[model samples]
Target: MNGPRERGRPGGADAADRALDDAVALANGPATARPGSRQPSTDPLVVALGHEPAGAGPAQARTRARQRPDAVAWPEARRLARRVGRRLDPRALPLGEDLLGMALARSLTALTDLPSFDSSAMDGWAVAGSGPWRLKGQVLAGQQRSADALLGGHAVRIATGAVLPPGTTAVLRSEHGSTQLRTDGEWLHVLASHSAPRAGQEIRRKGQECRGGEELLPAGAVVTPAVLGLAAAAGYDELTVTMRPRVEILVLGDELLDQGPPRAGRVRDALGPMLPSWLRGLGAEVTSVRRLVDDAGTLHAAVAASTADLVVTTGGTASGPVDHVHPVLAQLGATLLVDGVAVRPGHPMLLAQLPAGGLLAGLPGNPLAAVSGVLTLVDPVLRTLAGRPAPAPYAAPLTANVPGHPVDTRLVPVVFDDESAARPLHFTGPAMLRGLAAADGMAVIPPGGARAGQETAVLDTGALAPAWGSGA
Candidate 1:
């Protein structure tokens, strides 16, 4: 939830801003509700210092109402975030230990011809003509090329990957050719019924796989482990790759505790410990995670000082006494892009551009709501910046009917079963995390909801990627 509007805000809190917020809040429901509760038709609450009266858990989020005519539709919100990233500049880095999962900035052209030399593709004998052939010296991989050249009908013992001797026309695989020590010399002969070695058989011709300077992979390809191997095999000691988008996390809320159990009047800070790892999986270099109390000036300083490509913040999206996020944005003359999304529990989430540099993702304070924001907004943008391609969208039938949000789309945690159907889990309220912890994915239930056996879109979180870093 958000804190109160700070004093002397930009053009001063005129009647127009208040009227606009009220209309948008009324149109969307209350600016907020209890995190996990269903949307309620109610009037906006009078908040102070960014908090609601005594017992009402902080009002959900500030309604941006007409700021966007209405909150953006769920899918559109994602696309908007992606567009923001595409507009930003992409960084490039030389191949190194940190290149894993980064995207290719340019096509990976071969530094040298693949195979670079005519070489044996299998353990065989390099021969100039059909058998029976005279056999001479042996050739093994990694040895410098022998000065001797094979003559017509002459064969030499060779190993897989060995450079083919000059004048050799074809290779006879060891299994297909038999060698015998005759009275005068060694000779190799093909199998009794087997055919003769065809020209270029069992040989890897120079530049056959690719010519020097030929493109191996196009731009925007992710750098996977196999890609690294391929790059090394192609005689490349260096590669140009897309740099991971740098991100900084700003965790706001004075009532949140980072350690131990939630002490008197304080809940544990959940997002602070989770988002960094999650962001990395979605392709981001989380530069820092800073926890700040509900102070407008402090929040302003942090966001303004940040040099990262993205600045993700928790809470202060709603108009609560301490909800300072929006006010701070206005103070800095930032452009609000996706002011709010029409997703349950995360309707207050926002995306904006900083005046100086960087962008900010304002995630709702609720645990699960914040996660929804991360999925619907953060992932697409970060992946765009890092050059990671979006996963193919797929759907599965649901096991039950999920309640709808009238005008908003819903993302419910679900577990996929052998039937390839999604079993929607309970406890998936905007504020709840129990169902999500055990879920395979979040099912995107369209507005008006989906009935049992209906195919619903499933979102991938890319959680399978390794969470890497030095120990915290």
Candidate 2:
């Protein structure tokens, strides 16, 4: 398993040095002018990435200086996430119809030939001759009927799925044939209007779909409804699927209420109620959601005792007085894989590998920021662990201009307009959820922001649902 640690730091010293150079260059150089324009834009990410003009502003300069040198770029952070996911071993689960949406741990093979036996594919007469014939008894599905071999002019009534009798030649449809009451008494006959019956026309032969021991589905295929039906038909009562990753959430905040309206200085525990459902949608089995105090001891104990594969902590990622996540992680001898990200509304999010073999993702307390952290880190990691592939890249033109962060990428909520362009939504601050709730996805805005009509990457929130394939 090529784990993130074993892979060495992504974009090592030279990359870091280059990032530093870019940062310094942004601080010292003048902003580059847009094509055909004399003035330069003041996008924060652009400024942070060394596109800011010299003497842009004192505040911008100070902000650049204060930026953490170790902050990871958005793309690199995701690459590391994939590495972490690939390192973990996948557990095999017993198969059942309920295992739909789970990934197959191994290829599925047929235990028996499909259709299993030759059977009638329609309700008709199993005839032995080419024309008018003597009628035998009727044979329904699942019935065992024994009769003398049909002579050249004899036939028997048969229903769909009924096994063909001995000496059966071909099936003639009831509508295509008729009963004649003649001097020879009652007789079953083929109609004159119809042409000669084609042999094997309505017979479903054994192994029509698949033969015994044939490969039915490959490993990593998602167990969908069709797959389940196929598995049952192919003689499987159980299937081996990749186990869902176990997750334990720690919602940290002393000013959060579990079941009440906001009052005084406290607010509702938004993350506690939100994380579990979203995590489950991402193919994680949330083992627990524990609310802990802002104290370092409580967090340290929880982190040390967790048995889940991933430990997600909300809030306390910053260096403020109440921020204990960093200190607790440090005390536990955890390796900080990502200290901070170059993204808006979730810049304080962090990732670490614990000494106890569990991974920890520290998300900022703000509602939208926490969501950003989930997409940036948790989403990819769980998908990899579940044996799912990464989602394909998607982009759309912007319907309006979105303000950018000087040095960080921005994930802004947007709704699709009539033109299919993504229009940025309002009330999209780090602490707000209104915009997100009404949004189709979050548009990826680069530094210096994007002008109207510019193409931008979009991350669909609906991709988190299990029905959405590998993104789930």
Candidate 3:
């Protein structure tokens, strides 16, 4: 069942030579320019990613603006991400964690007939005809069906769930029938008060539920726990399930520590530890989590070498000196599919297609901003590739005022109120995660912001906390 992804090459690792060429282009790509409008940062990455930096002067900004693609709207960016993944072929994966949460690639068929044998459904007497009959044999659950066929006026003492003997027409339940030993091979009689057993009474006939090879569930059915149980009963040891999108997370920044508390200006790595599980929950198979410094060449090599369906890089998506995502993409001849998004906190987030193969999502440095990028880009792509159904659109009224960016949409982490209104949480700045940790979902506030009692679309975060979470 294991085969290379037929999207062509079993994609992981591109040739180093191509990566080197890309690196060379990165080294000499942007011309050295004096700081124009904003003081600290330059215009290379931002301009290339279609963002007008806060510091660029009129002439320089105008010059750079003409060479850039406009940042995509919040909704459009997500749509682009989904579009890129539509071509990925689903796989016939064997059942396991790999299959968990993935849609079935094909219909699940019954491997064997349901109740493959004629059996007793309860503790009863298997009879050939009306009783007041001779007891000929005995049968218990799991015992072989009687080799001798039953004759008229004869019965077998059968336990619950026992396979009924051939030629048996009906079952007389033990409680409704009485036995006597007047010799002549011990007789069985139906209690007149209970009446005689009817035809096929208490005898579970084979294939009554479903016959062999019948389709039990249609293709596109999700492999839930109940499905697994049903599959086991239908003679399946493994399930043929849809492939999960493979993702590789690259945590960028030299000022990030792999462990220990923040020290010497370096902060503890948050995305590295969290993205793997988060991506898994979103239906992507996180293949690897690599920690790298903010070096263009390292990022370039890593991106080029990855065979994952999607490569996610945290930090270094802006126009800072350390920002290398844009430069690397330019060198690699990659198409900036969703060059940048107009959402707050993650306005610099980008989605790109590597020429070698696969896609990359560039998330902003701040934890919360990175999360926004995931929702805007990574989540949509994975869903399409994994064949997961998109959640139904939903909205909730706001319990309090939610501030918004004038021209950009805001994704505010919120808890539900007593009336099921979405209550915006505090500490929801781009760099913070505290508010998100306490949130049930993110309320999508339009450009003008949302007022109390105003209904706004809410994106499900999958963590539906209890009513206690509804409190401020």
Per-candidate clash tally:
22, 14, 5
Give the local distance difference test score of model 3. 0.72
How are the candidates ranked when ordered by TM-score, highest leading?
A: 1, 2, 3
How well does candidate 1 score on lDDT at residue 193? 71
Model 3 ranges with Cα > 4 A deviation = 1-69, 86-98, 116-136, 141-161, 164-214, 416-421, 451-455, 462-472
Error of 3 at 111 (Å): 4.0
* Candidate 2 wrongly placed segments (more than 4 Å): 1-68, 86-94, 127-134, 144-155, 165-205, 416-421, 462-472
Model 1 agreement with the true structure over 197-283: per-residue lDDT tens digits? 889999999999999988898776777777888998986677777678889999999989978998899999989998898888776
CA shift of 260, model 3, Å: 2.6
TM-score, candidate number 2: 0.77
Q: Rank the candidates by lDDT, best first.
A: 1, 2, 3
Candidate 3 structure quality by residue, lDDT tens digits, 372-450: 9988888778766776554444456678877676556688988876666678899989989999998878777765565
TM-score of each: 0.77, 0.77, 0.70
